[model samples]
Each structure stands twice: as structure tokens, then as C-alpha cells.
Target: MSMAQRERQQLVEAMTAAGPEAPTLCGAWTVRDLAAHLVVRERRPDASPGIMLKPFAGYLDGVQTKTARKPFPELLEEVRTGPPWWSPLRPVDAIVNLTEMFVHHEDIRRGTPGWEPRELPAADENALWSFARRMGRRAYRRSPVTVVLATPDGKRAVVHSKPSGEVILTGKPSELLLHAFGRDEVRLETTGDPESVRAVLSLDRSV
Candidate 1:
């Protein structure tokens, strides 16, 4: 299966194993709340603008809250079955949902005790790296100094370039993606001038 499909299936399975009440790393969201978010994001496009636009957030929250009130089984079924036939996301699932699924899967997996990082296939790591590179600027846009993404083996990309200085964040592709997405559970090394590193670290990189 494609990485996106694999991750989506795995996320559903993880959600099933964890049950509705399980906590996720997504702030105060429970597994049920995350499920409702996934459902509303794909199925309720009219409300999805709130995901990135603050003005629509209240409307989006209203829709998501209502969706969460559905029976947990039905909510999960929607997430497992994928988007509806007419939804635009159906045709671009891999391009769009890969990171969304992977990160949220980790959110659930790592939020619980006894979790460990998975050894992902090299191709999956490459995919995450590509996505991270593309997202570099937007992810680190608020940083006061230049931000650099580096893999353990030395692959590097500049996120926010500044003449002043840069902070290098080193980790595996998956870990870098996690950190870029504002997840604190990832294992990564931040290096650079101490002052610049602190500035980068203090910046919120969440979507």
C-alpha cells in the first residue's frame, strides 16, 4: 500500500486499540475528538477553512463538536472508510493526507505510556523529508533566526534564512517532521549558537 494508505489504516487500528477516551498529543484532544476532526476535515469542506483561518474556527469547531457527538463506532467508520465520493480530497489523498495521518498516528501512539518510535521504511522517510522541506518556511516562519533542518547523516535544508544566524535541528526525517509540526514528543538535536537555538526552540511550529 502507499504510505498514506498504510498510515491511515494504521491510525484507524491504533484508534480502535486505544478506544475513544484515550488522550492524544494534540493539546486537549481525545481520540474521539481527533476522529471527529478527521471526519469533519474530509467530509465537511465548507467548515474546513477554519482549520487554517481563525475567522472560520468557531464554525469549524461547531461542526466538529457535533460530529464528535455521533456514536464512536460511526465516527471511526468514517475515518476508516476515507472521504466521500464527491469530496475533492479523494483524488489527492496521498499528497495531502500523508503527513496528516502520520503525525496524528504518532499523536495517539506517543501520548500513551510505553510508546516507542517505529523504524519506518526508507521510502517513507524520504517522503516525510520532502514534505518537511516543502513546509520548512511556513513551519518556521515565526522564528527570529534562520532555521536549518538536518538529518542524522548530514542531509540539510534551510527553513527560514536569516543573515544573523541559524539553528540546526538534527534528527531522522520522521522526527524532523514531528518537530516541524509542533510535536514535542520527537527525539531531535538542536544545535547552533546557543542564543539562536533558543530563539528557534521557543517558536511554535504547529500547523
Candidate 2:
């Protein structure tokens, strides 16, 4: 199966196991809320802009709240079924949902008790590393210092650069992906000039 498909199934399983009330790393969103958000993102194009733009946020919030009120089984089913035929996501599921599913899966896993990192296939690791490289630039685009993402396996990318100094974030591809998605519950090492390190840490790295 494709990476996106694999992660989607795993995300559905994780959500099912955790139940509706289970907490996630997405601020105050529970499993129910996260599932609703995913459903709306794929099925409700009108409110989907609210996910990224501020003016549409209220509409998105209202949609998500209403979706969340559905029976948990129904909501979970939508997430598992993938986007509808007419939805734009149907054609780009592999590209768009790959990171989306993986990060959210980790959100559920890390937010719950007794969690540990999973052993990912080499291909999946390479895909995640590419995602980190691409999204990391956007996350640190305005940083005052140069930023580098490095993995123990020697794969590295200079996502952001500045003349001031450098800050390097080192971790596995999966952990770096989590960090790029504004998640704090990741295993990573930050090493660089003191001021530069602090600056990068203080920045909001969420996607």
C-alpha cells in the first residue's frame, strides 16, 4: 500500500483504540475533535479554508463542532473511508495526506500514556525526511538565524539560512516530521549557538 494509505489505516486504528474522549497533542482536541477536523477537511471544501486563514476560522469552528456531535462511529468511519469522489483530496491523497496522517497518528500515540516510537520502513523514513525538508523551510522561513535539519543517518537539509548563526535540529526522520508539525512531543536534539538555539526553539514551528 502507499504511505498515505498505510498511515490512514493506522490512524483509524489508533483513533478507534483511544475512543472518543481520548486526548491528542492537538491542543485541547480529543480523538473525536481530531476525527471531525479530518472529515471536514476532506469533505467540506467551503470551511476548509478556515484551517489556514483567520477570517474563515469561525465558520470552520462551527462546522467542526457540528461534525464532532455526530456519533463517534460515524465520524471515525468518514476518516477511514478517505475523501469523497468529488473531493479534491481524492486525487492528491498520497501527496497531501501522507504527512497529515502520519503526524496525527503520532499526535494520538504521543498524547496517550505508555507510548513509544514505532520502527518505520526505510522507504517511509525517506519520504518523511523529504517532507521535513520541504515543510521545515516554511516553518522557519522568517527565522533570524540559519536552521539545519539533520538526521543521525547523515541526511541533512539547510531549510533556513541567515548570516547571524546556525541552529541544528537532529533526530530521526519521524521525530523531525513531528517537530515540523508544531508538535512538542518528539524526541530530538537541538545543538547550536546558544542564542540561535533559543531563537529557533521559541519560534512557532507548527504547519
Top candidate, metric lDDT: 2
lDDT (C-alpha) at residue 119 in model 2 = 92
lDDT of 1 by residue, 1-207 (tens): 778989999999999999999999999999999999999999999998999999999999999999999999999899988889999999999889999999999999999878889999888998899988877778899888888899977799988888888789999999988888888888888888888887887787878
What TM-score would candidate 2 get against the native? 0.97
- The whole-model C-alpha lDDT of candidate 2 against the native structure comes to 0.92
TM-score, every prediction: 0.96, 0.97
Steric overlap count per candidate = 0, 0
Candidate 2 Cα outliers beyond 4 Å, as residue runs: none
- For model 2, residues 1-207, the per-residue Cα lDDT tens digits are 799999999999999999999999999999999999999999999999999999999999999999999999999899999999999889999999999999999999999778889999988999999999988989888789999999999998999989988999999999988888788788899988788888888889865
Candidate 2: lDDT of 184?
79
- Give candidate 1 misplaced runs (Cα > 4 Å): none
